[model samples]
Target: MSTQDPQPESTGSIRRVESSTAASGSSVEETPPSTETTESSSRQSLFAEEELSVLRLRWDEVQSGFVDDPRECVQKADGLVSDVVDRLTTGFSEARSRLEEQWARGEEGSTEDLRLALKRYREFFQRLLAL
Candidate 1:
């Protein structure tokens, strides 16, 4: 006969694997996010930034023509600026959604940065359009 002390049962020693019927009859397993998803998101954000920068540069180029003109020229430039602002606003909205979603996945550094940059650029462009 072995000499051993009898141990009392405790919650820590319990192993209860409940049936799925207790919940939804199914267990969900989380999968890591795909690289393709991340890369595609990154590419879209980069494209938005590049597009805005190019548009801004073109606006500056065009504004040169109005530098020495009358009020009519200023009004025309104002209209053009408004159109560009609308386009940039749309792009900024889309990028903000994507960047926010990506950021929710715990990748905050670059994604947060891009979101802020896009937002700032949007505001800056709108200010210019107002002028």
Candidate 2:
């Protein structure tokens, strides 16, 4: 009796691994381990590195000022969060507009490209839900 190694099947961003035991005619299906770092790096960021650094600096200032004026610190934090949300909303809108333009111009991207875009949207939606 021989056991075969699991074979990988990819469907868009998702992958499935399947293995079967010939003796008992049993099969198992599993999802492969996620490469979070690689995948996250590949996905587009809503903010630039410089923007993120500036935001971090501002956050640090707000935190440091909390000891002096707690109410003002809370207000600043609320404003910062609002700005971040606005920026994120604008970023997503811009991306969607670009894609829509391409489609309208008869330049619809490849199936894989569209699939990746949808995957990114799904990931963003999941994150928003978590919040």
The C-alpha lDDT values of all candidates are 0.43, 0.52
Best by lDDT: 2
TM-score per prediction, in order, is 0.28, 0.61
- How do the residues 29-109 of candidate 1 rate in per-residue lDDT, one tens digit apiece? 234325553333322322234444554555565566675775756676676556554554565565567678878987675
Worst 10 residues of 1 by lDDT: 1-10
Model 2, 23-101: lDDT tens per residue? Answer: 2322221233255633443343444445556667777788789999999999998887776666666655666787899
Model 2, stretches more than 4 Å misplaced? 1-46
For residue 57, give model 2's deviation from the true position in Å.
0.8
Clashing pairs in model 2, backbone N/Cα/C closer than 3 A: none
Report how far residue 19 has shifted in candidate 2, in Å: 24
